[model samples]
Target chain A: MTTQEPTNAENWAKPVDSLHIAHDLPDHAINLNVEGKRVASMTSGFGKMWQKTYRVRLDGARVAPQQVVKVWKEHFPEFWQKGQHFFGPMASISPGDVALINVKTGGVKLSTGILVLYADDVSFSFMTPEGHMFTGMITFSARELEDGVTQAEIVALVRAQDPIYELGMMTMGSGAEDRQWLHVLRSLAAHFGVEGKPTLEKICVDRKRQWKRFGNVRRSAAIRTVFYSVTRPLRRKEKTRASA
Target chain B: MDFSADVRQIDGLAVIDLHGEIMAGADDALTSGFVRATTGNTGPVLLNFADVSYINSTGIALIVGLLAEARASDRRILVSGLTDHYKDIFEITRISDFVTMCDDEESAAAAAKA
Candidate 1:
């Protein structure tokens, strides 16, 4: 059997760019101001017991931080579980700037995490948990592939310590959170100025397929657990009756 | 901040019309409403969305979560009367793919009945 050469479409499927922003962010995180409007106040750290860079994106914009915080409090419970917004009476954001916010957390410490931000038309912020803290930074350089769609190319680098290795971590979970960020990127792009239907369609199709695969895996796992649960007792009963 | 849900049985179908935005602090209400809508229903449930204008990621996640819960119970949940803006957001997130959408309350109710 002859194998067909992979097409440009297959090649374009890869991310355009990705960077470990957790490392390059300044220890004293920089303040993000949008045209004199303070959007978010972030703090960064390095070389701790966790060794991972950490940053906190406090919501501030034209809207009152209190109002945004209220909205966040009203809608997102998982964030509340992370910690109380003690930095100030700040709001996360409401109905603007962000199209979506996706978060992923796992591992023994549950300290490692990734937060992806999809702003307008291919803008993104990847926040990775380092050591015991999280770092926040923007990865601004992304280019469109021949498939005529754009993907994020993260350029930020870090040098303090390899948080993953420093933490003595062995495995990294799947980057499903990263893929969701890509979808948010595409949606933001379309929301702003990108007018390519095919590109948007391709992104949607890819996401649907990915979600379907995830669903299948979950369903199979559930089925297996249920099957074992149902049969375990039967085997015990059979052995008891046979011995009698 | 509080979610209020009213479920009326019309033509043997459960029509769940929700008022107020579904966000973080009010998850309990939303989850309870969904549970009530799907529980003990012999037929489909049509969710009326004309009044819901704003939903955060958590709110959207609740909808998905409810859908998954309903699916396990073999109950069908359909959304109707979504504004264009909300529809656009839902489309991108692909929530529409999992649940059916209708243009108006009547059609959604009818679909549920059928």
Candidate 2:
């Protein structure tokens, strides 16, 4: 993160910053669940860490890696699964931009956000905030295959922040995540008018859950967002004041 | 583009001296360095990043993969020579929670010995 060091590294990643204080939401984003939370990485969560990769082959497409990525970044939200919304800043993909997200896992509606951890011509990555369901980084990349085709991929290195998320993932939650990213890749491929069958690979990086981080459950976005939603009437004034 | 790892063992601990930036292309060198360090040694591994100049998010993921490999075999990995800034990255990523940090190789090795 040092400016004096490798320019390549600095170009790829922004200086690490933790979100400690709440900030006023932009007109495009919601303020719940993300304010006052720090960015959570793989090590911050309570569950066993996992490395999941979901990829699709954009066969018959003649797009270069950089071009695919350009389109991906420019229309990032368009590729997401239905019911999932990503609200980024007005500017294009760059280091340090935050994305306000509203997503659904199975039937549960969750509000959360992510930080743009790294970006370049061919790939970009997002890291979750502390209260988010997945605490780690998910990288999206478009690369040229050996056959001159483009392959769009999503690699998620994450751990569930708390027991709630871990349990949810164990049940239908994991599949939901898988489906979400698969849908994204397919949508990206469809943009090129190519049919894609995204493949998935998942690995458990660590099996022992850190019991010490059990307290993270208190910050679970699912619970917090639900609380925020149900009690909207009570906080309407505060919300209005913050906007003012 | 030029990354290297020099490994030396003390009291069954492997101390890896890393040089250059750890980014996407440093994979082979980093993984091979681990292989060399643990091929004959059974104790913990201590990474000395004093000479390392930079690391990107992908580089961080590669290290997490290494940690996963280490944990699978019951190997403890310690770290030393992380700049305050890089140390903060480790903390933000939560890798610090698993790996013990020491100011220098001597302490990391001794801690491993303990």
Candidate 3:
């Protein structure tokens, strides 16, 4: 690596002042907790850190890694499980793009977003903004195995962003996350006309929690989204009265 | 080129010389290198990336995993020889917060001794 000629220079997103969603989203896409938020890396979260990987071999598909990645990037949201909405930009997934997500988990609808941290022919990654359920980077990629099978994989290095999320992670949130990625891989494999059984590996990278980050609860998107929903009727009445 | 890691002791610091592109395939080399570097040494471990060609997002996650391990063991970490681009990356990923970034091997060794 040299100062004048950095390798893979075009593959990374330029450093940003803060995250900003530039794309127009659907009418129902609750666009909160993303704009003006700084990306929350694994270090910034409050809970124990974990590295979870989900993988599935596309058996008999015979697709190259780059081809799989290209298809995945082009149809990114279609592979996600139902009820989890990802609104990517009109263009393909690229470095610096901000994507909105509306997901219903345990009967609560939460809206959050991710910054496209890096992208290349074989892989792309998303980093969560502050107030997301987890602070982390999720990378999706494909690689060729020894037997010439292309394996699609998702690796997430994450930690719960607040105490409430930490509690959820300890209960049902972690398992739900696992299932979500598994569904994605299965969908991707099915797209190539193959039946794929995904495998998972979880590693507890750090057991200690950062107690100092307890204040992050104030920025929780779940709490904010719930409040927004609860006060919608009042907001509608206020609008009607003002118009009259 | 394939990824490789070499560990050397400099002024009691374990300096890991890293070469080649760092991606998902480099996991074994990186982990084994860290283990060898910190096995008996109580001082800081320095990762010298002077010869590294490229690092993807997966590579960055591997470094974060290493940082987590170092913190868990109460050990210090030092990084040296990253290009300007990766220096920015280290900042963006917040890895610079936990590890001391040095410009070259000599200063890193001096700091390790100090």
Candidate 4:
């Protein structure tokens, strides 16, 4: 890790102000924001998909892409166990350029994808199982907010699409997918040490409310079916009894 | 392919100790050992992993299958002596929530008795 500040040119090429969009045919688009500013956005056309976004501020300095990859591999070896290889060559990373890896492989049926972002003051990534590909972005910037602590905001916008989302709809309700997204966010926060703060707590609570709303809908449907079964026969019996 | 087992009649617990790497081709032996421990035994079983070196996904599936069988038969199954690396992997997959963890053979045996 280097403590040196990123040069002006490096920052300008991958500008802090502009948004970069990347998408392949039939894949999802990814959108990212840097320092609370939109930097990149991408969108994909896959039916029923999964998306995850994560951001974190590092205290020491920016770590190189290789080092970041090394750390990730160490922490998540099982991810590599399924034979998903790392994309691009390792030597292509320049001084300030962040490396992005889109993993596509493993587990059950659908093709899973993982996107990794490595930067000086922040690192984030998203992982999804098959049929669910994530499209999201991460931005890194620093500002002097308080005297000592720096204010770093990492926001993740994720959605479940495709089979899992559809399965959730069939089994758990529409909001079930949203609850899964909440778990993804919490897991990302835990990985980056961004959890336990008041803001994150509020975010989780909001997700919980969505889950409960969908749960209520499912419960009501179940109750309606039970009620219909119990009343239909009774009405017929009463009519017969009156005719008799 | 190293496997050992000791059946304690008083406690009605079977402790099976496995060693070496557990991968795809070697799962049958492991599965057989687990079956031997549980068959005709109406009590709990504890898998002692103190000597085990590594386990792949297939190995994990075998263990889960054994646990499922034990549960179906109203018998409890506990896993004892996991290394930190194994523990971390299990935690990531949420497998620890499904299986009981014990510190040693004695604790596993005692818990099985209860």
Candidate topping TM-score: 3
Q: Residue B53 CA error for candidate 3 (Å)?
A: 1.3
TM-score of 4: 0.37
Best by DockQ: 3
Worst 10 residues of 3 chain A by lDDT: A1-10
- Model 1 Cα lDDT, one tens digit per residue, A67-177: 333333233323322321112112432122221112232322221223332222222233332222222233323334445434333222211123332222223322222
Better of 3 and 4 by DockQ: 3
Which residue segments of model 1 deviate by more than 4 Å? A1-244
Would you list the clashing residue pairs of candidate 3? none
Instruction: Record all residue pairs in model 2 with backbone atoms less than 3 Å apart, i.e. clashing.
Output: none
List the candidates ranked by TM-score, beginning with the highest: 3, 2, 1, 4
- Ten-residue segment with the worst summed lDDT in candidate 2 chain B? B85-94
Any idea how many clashes model 2 has? 0
Weakest 10 consecutive residues, lDDT, candidate 2 chain A?
A1-10
> TM-score for model 3?
0.95
DockQ per model, Cα = 0.01, 0.39, 0.57, 0.01
Off by over 4 Å in 4: A1-27, A30-244, B1-10
